[model samples]
Target: MKRRFTVSVILSRCSLASSWIFYSEYFYNYQNEGRVEWVYGDGFAHNLNNVNNLVSSLRFVGDEDNWKMDSITLFEFDLFFGIEYYDWTDNTQVPSGMSTVGSLIITGQNYWTVYTSTNFSGNRACLQVQSGQYVGFAADLDEYGIFTVRSYRRGCFGDKKITLNSDQHGFAVKARE
Candidate 1:
């Protein structure tokens, strides 16, 4: 006999998060370059005309930054599902045989930048790392724009350290500014 699996079982194995983007068919041009036809979020995609696979460029228009601190994990499917690519170091391009990026997982105390095209060209989004303690699970790239990730660079803000010390009055204080 052979063991069988279900979609729910497979989903349960990996953690899930809320947030997604409506990918377009062209590069970022103030939404004028292409039409927004693919909506992916919360672990599923509303694919139309197979536009989800044709996303080429994206630009984050908002000022929001900061993401969960963890090792980078790129998913081939929305909502942090499918073909997971985990890495701690930066890369100029996606892994061999992997092309599209549906989601991201940023780790550690350093912010990372994910680009739409290779060599950090084309559209880009800077995922800032949360300050203080690291949260195990983080929100997926929420509305960061719609473009597949091709290359990524770590240490967006470099390594930040916070030191605690006791002052003369025995009161805990942050060491540096």
Candidate 2:
């Protein structure tokens, strides 16, 4: 028998000088037990007006000693399955077939330190980060028959002409008779 699922996207207003963007997709199989999976893409951008003015003014006054500022772009994708039982023993490990190019970190399992790297894929499975702890569970596996998927970004401050953008999107599923 097939099961029913629903998805939603909630967005907050962008800051006066900031912007946020995010998108995500989800999949699930209830007949096979309570199996759930999802993937998301997020982007962040900030304006650069102060830096530009500082450079131009220094050049005009012939005082171009040197000035510098840091700019960063962060991108991430997360894929995982949710189960009802706390024990993940029979969950199947499958790849999403999608990749990202940027600074990335993947962590799961309780009390385990974050693994920092340029790329991460397929090495870690059945592990989840919840309440700052890494927990593992199985797929098609349901004890309470409920699961959740989520993604988001936090905002920060900036100067004039400098705008920041933040956005997020994802999905979820629940078992019903």
Pick the TM-score winner: 1
Predicted candidate 1 versus true structure: per-residue lDDT over 1-177, tens digit per residue: 322211111211211222222233333222223332212122432223423344443221111232232456676644433355777678899997666666555544556677778887766666653455232222234445646878888755223221211111110111112
Candidate 2 Cα deviation (angstroms), residue 130? 3.9
Error at 74, model 1, angstroms: 0.3
Model 2 residue 70 lDDT score: 16
Where in model 1 is the C-alpha error above 4 Å?
1-70, 135-142, 157-177
Off by over 4 Å in 2: 1-90, 95-126, 132-177
Which predicted model would earn the best lDDT?
1
TM-score of each: 0.46, 0.15
Q: What TM-score would you give candidate 1 relative to the actual structure?
A: 0.46
